[model samples]
Target: MRSLKKSLVHMLSVPLLLSLSCHSFADLTIDGKPAPHQNLSTHDVKELLADDDELELTPQGSTTASTTLRQSNGAPPAMHSGVVDTTFMNNAGPNVHAGSALVMDAQTGEVLFSKNSNSSRPMASITKLMTAVVTADAHLDMSQDITLEPIDFDGPKKASTKLRAGDKMNRAEVLLVALMKSENPAAAALARTYPGGKPAFIAAMNAKARELGMSSTHYFESTGLDPRNVSSARDLAILVTQAYKYGVIRQFSSTPHYDFNLGYRMLNASNTNALVRNGGWNINLSKTGFINEAGRCVVMHTTVNSRPAVVVLMGEPTTQARNTDATDLLNWLTGLPKDT
Candidate 1:
């Protein structure tokens, strides 16, 4: 949220994102109708959670699921599906909390549990998931050298990378750092590097969303700081489903820290997601995001109930709420019979 300055030191051109910026936003549509502004029922949410497809942070900012977990102390509940148990999911412990959430089966793309999964909400930096993915797919030689131009600083929000005009970094190092640390400048730079500038990159992002079957999602910016970058939990699950499959994305997103040298300075990047430290959750793909508009958001891929799954929570009023929502769902997942 700093003032936008002129002169982008980075020499990259972003044709894609610039195009996206020009088009006026259309109201979201899903399943051939206007997107449901409200959340889905818990029952409908539960159905979506059982699917094996889960959110992948574009496999960027993505290390989808580390795997393996233990049983919860509670008795297993009867599941609604051939896979996970709905009754167990319905029975929430006192700690379960969030404004919106959905637990998804990573492999089958089923919903095992949900609260307000259909509502479109601001996503904050989780939009980086798509940013990371597009970078990987663009075939940019990540090892290629580039400088952070001042033009890269004009994102919807502040540039947290502390990059001033003329700072230099490689593609791979910046990509890894930006996704993990949630750097605004790096995201803008990544977008600007694409064809058609930032607008074209954003267009490509929405196009990619369409290709992946994300029925209710759109990206106006790469850093996710833009309030206009929004999606529902249901649509986000589809985003993660395609995101978790990338090897590089998976490695970088799950990493707790990365050290890179910018000339004489050593840049240390870390993730905001506390689940990385939970010890209980075998996190595969995870990203944490927040802004006043979005509250707090987290999307994770993990093995709960001994099966791969995705969990998406958005608009939790507090950081604690985000953690609570994810943890409670994990508890529900662990309590369900593995075969239920």
Candidate 2:
């Protein structure tokens, strides 16, 4: 009976000893050196732990201090991983007055300079570029004449056009008017006459945007009068590049002037983009837009420094400001005089 009692006592003492051992270890210095209980205060423990690199615990549960700190704090304020951040170099080049702008290499899709390139804003008449693309891609009968109707005039904003309610023009001619002169009614007519009508035409525009990797672009109407027709400078650059692929779009957009006759009367229209009409630069594709919400907007595929490039300028305060912004960009790229 005494032997059985002694065995139980030994087992209980064993657990007590193990607990004491753990408590002793917890009271020691973080470097594994023996420390008195009085020296194991919270401050002392923190200091010891900080000095002992191997015992340091990181947010990621790793012992590497440098990497852990960097990961915890994130990248520096000025560093941009993927998109171009022009904050540092805003003054390095010409002073651009546009609210947002982008210059990209058309051949390689490389961003040359960007300021808020991903910010979406109303695109104004530049929306016609997508309208032209969708119309051309549909392979509609270009010679089929479409009569101007009151429905085409349906929009919140009234657009100026010489075509009367009963005036008639073929699809190709209307497309030219839309691209060259930015005629809102002509663009709406193109969409209205599409196989699935305006809804399908708008759907095709968005579908084309997706196909071209314009993730930040959206279109609500063929004419850009709706402030809802919005896109970013980056997306517009992609658009200008894609639109340049179509020979007809390039031809029509770059045309200096065009005349249309309604048999009883003649309506003459000129390209809204003065750069195309001025013949001062080699502009392969050009489109301009304006609305109260959109400001002055322009997108072009032109030669910069003898290399193909796409330039997008949006939210300029005035028509001259938009033109000046484009000229300044071209001059900077091509090494022209700063005063030019």
Candidate 3:
């Protein structure tokens, strides 16, 4: 009788233990703590999981879990949020071949595009722009004949020029050649003839840059052959915009070709900027620059999508690359909304 009673008690305890084990499975956590196990409707499930993490529902009616899981795991967010819009954010803008570049609205000074724009670099013949500006500000006798001297041919590059030692040309003609053709001797002669000579002319250039808020620009010499003649793309854009206000610079820099009687021969000088010579671009102001230190460079004031804009490109590997970069930027700007 005792054994049967013991056996019956053991059988009862076994079924009770099995029942507890089956019902005691782990509960899911909603907010870092265990939630009560219960039958949850779709709405209830959403409400429970909503505060815990961000969830995406699939077309199959299943919750896809947190999209921010990567963030929690120390991953950076995507470069662009949501669907990418090519109009506002162009992936190709950063791919421009120039080491430094900037595009700004000529009238409003609004920056539209930039890459290393503030980093100062050698500006090569773009120095002529400032040379032109300082010469213009002098208000000298543009018609007065100025003779080129040995000091004017002091650059290390030994570039060929139509003007020879003792070759006399009117100040206006000199200015035209200096700007349009990047004539080194003409620029040096302009600085040489300044009131206090080259030193005073360089000081005036710095002063003019300060006046125009080009803090990153500095000029060691009038001719950009000196590698120390440096400025940032941002600063060059400012210089170009200010220079565009001068009608002489606009006309001279944009002239495709100019014929001048040097008495010995009829010398013809063409604009250094190919875009200006191409006739397809409505270039208001243009300048091209190059040296071993500063690669192919260009600055221009042109209308893009009917908006006047200043573009500065520096340290491009090739002239063709620089032109293509400018064209790509122009097309990108044209595609953008007018408000941009």
Taking the tens digit of each residue's C-alpha lDDT, what string does model 2 give over 1-340?
A: 3342222122211111111111121221112232233212233223322332222222111111121001112322222223544532222566778877887656544555677776778899999999988887776666567898998888979878777788787666688788988988899999999999999999999999988767668899999999999888877877876666554566667766655667777676678988877878877679999999999999987765446667889899999999988988887777632222
* lDDT (0 to 1) per candidate: 0.61, 0.67, 0.68
Off-target runs (Cα >4 Å) in candidate 1 are 1-95
Q: Provide TM-scores for the models.
A: 0.72, 0.73, 0.72
Candidate 3 residue pairs that clash? none
In candidate 3 the C-alpha lDDT for residue 190 amounts to: 95
Give the poorly placed runs of model 2, Cα more than 4 Å off. 1-91, 336-340
Q: What are the per-residue Cα lDDT tens digits for candidate 3 across 1-340?
A: 3342222222211111100111221222222234333332333222322321222222111122221112212432222212221221223454688888877656555566766676788999999999988887776756567899998998867776777888777776788789888999999999999999999999999999888767678899998999998898777887886676554566567666666567766666678887777766667778999998999999987776567777889999999999899888877777766554
lDDT of 1 by residue, 1-340 (tens): 0111010101011000100121211222211233223222333222222221342332212334322111233322222112221222434533445556777666544456665666677888889989987876676655455688877777566635556677677666567667767777888888988868888899999999878756567888888878999887766776776767654455456655444557657565556787764445667667888888998999887766457778888888889878877887777787865544
The top-ranked prediction according to lDDT is: 3
How accurate locally is residue 218 in candidate 1, as Cα lDDT from 0 to 100? 82
